[model samples]
Target: MKKENLPPFKITNEILTLIYEIGELIGKISVTQEFEKNLILRRENRIKTIYSSLAIEQNTLTLEQVTDVINGKRVLAPLKDIKEVQNAYEIYERLDELNDNSVKDLLLAHKIMTSELIKENGKFRSKNAGVYQGEKLIHMGSMPAHIPELINNLFLWLKNSKEHPLIKAAVFHYEFEFIHPFQDGNGRIGRLWHTLILSKWKDFFGWLPIESLVQKYQKEYYTAINNSNRDGESTEFILFMLKIINETLIELIENQKMTDKMTDKMTDKNKKRIEVILKYLSQKNYIDNKEAQNLLDVSEATAKRFLNKLVKENILEAVGEYKARKYIKK
Candidate 1:
């Protein structure tokens, strides 16, 4: 479908304004700080978790199965469907190599990540398929003969669009999902490739896990896409994606501010206390009063009270019974 002839899709000024603001804030985030390293690790972990969860929800695997793959307890195998969780990891690991503007590199990344699913895993499908809505399918099938040309044209638009890179990436994501080009793994590929495209425009996006935000609203994500397919317009999906991006940015900024405030006020005593907690958490996500007391050189009641206070303030999460309780950073 031609860009102008496709639909009346357009972004609202309100969302455009928010995107610019977020772009500015993200540009200002310092990448050299120790805290930034922690943030990047946390973001990467969340991204993996989100991709894994989505794959599971799509019935490609169970939650336990995806976790096993992520933890390296299982090797990838060609199975019932594409292992999207594995594909997500492959993309993230090789992002540095594909950071340049070469279309060939991007296509190669897609092929490498998806080759197990179909003969054309990383490439567009040569056969036609209909876009679906409920039990109904719309747009009918593209002429089998025209499938190759249609996909090539779509990719050409993706490469040439003059839209804001972020907006273009979002549009391409929706279009790819609507086209359902591959025999399988279309949703996962579309989302991952969109992240790849956006990361090329802004290095910070290489670390931002927008999938986590989308996972939180999966119903909306699917509905927005289906609605746009029915209407032949992607404006709703673009607006929805922009909102997700904005909310994710706000959450990250708020968390960073809180961490900064906590760090700034750290005395030698509290710094030592936090160091003890971090060491314990690095091994496992939780610690009990006994462990805290032993690590922090504090009385049992003092340890309990301090840990409980952190939980109450939303800075930590508590689990298990009173004496058996453990704390985790929120």
Candidate 2:
């Protein structure tokens, strides 16, 4: 196999500053009452991440549609749009199982993410590919025969590189796009894989939802990618992504503050119950009366009261019949 050299990138003051800012925000959030305990906020951020990431790829489904689709409800969007959401949801649900340094794992994720939408779902393209803006060709991908070798080298470098995880992941994302390994779904997979890389470094990043911010600056996103391509270095792209991550962490800290103020009057007992419920919900996605009781080591009445109170406060949505009802993070 041909071994290709990894692309070069220079870290500037901007990247270092953003990293420091992100770490400071994460430090503040780590001590907050809601950092790991805010179940509802985590779920909402997840939905936003999925919707916005797909939206950047022109998936037409709205946030509500994405939520409904995730809940296994019928959505009246194009079959392609619906399938993209379903596939992405499935991939993200098992992100912990993915290996960031394995090309095979990358292909498998692409397969899961593009299932039913592309004939070559998990496989790299056998033909050339080009990224275009309307009729303008912005970037032409590496030759098809070279993709495997190029990607293999990329992962090899990632495994051996001593670079910080943040910088390494940002560089990997940029190089992945430049390679355009797959004929379809490259953009989405690049973004998704970057999160996977970061999550492996810090599990908290698994639910950080940086993609939501990326979607907000969609034009700048492409411009950064284009500029990096032009410069043949990933400095600009790294800075751009670091900014997104920094902003996302800042938003998380801000949201945690809001939660603190809103729940200032909540009793210690009630706060503990919500924390327990959030942990359970994080793992199972929903908590029924029986499961809640078992998970919390509480009686049926107590579980029901706690769950009902959360529902009343708009922290969760109560679904199903009275006896069979379950509470899902809202």
Give the top-scoring candidate (TM-score): 2
lDDT tens digits by residue: candidate 1, 226-307: 7887778888898888888888778767766776766676677776677567645644557888888888889999998878
Model 2 spans with C-alpha error above 4 angstroms: 1-4, 31-36, 268-330
CA lDDT of each prediction against the hidden true structure: 0.67, 0.86
Specify the highest-lDDT model's number.
Answer: 2
* Collision pairs in model 1: none
TM-scores for every candidate against the unseen true structure: 0.75, 0.80
Model 2: lDDT equals 0.86
Residue pairs whose backbone atoms clash in candidate 2: none
RMSD of each: 4.7, 6.7
Least well predicted 10-residue stretch by lDDT in candidate 2: 31-40
Instruction: Put down candidate 2 lDDT per residue, 1-330, tens digits, no spaces.
Output: 122485788878878888888778777766334536656666766777889999999999988788889989998989999999999999998898999989889999999999999889899999999999999999999999999888988998899999999999999999999999998999999999899999998887888889989999999999999999988899999999999998888887776766675467799877777777875564466789999889778999988998898888888899999997988988
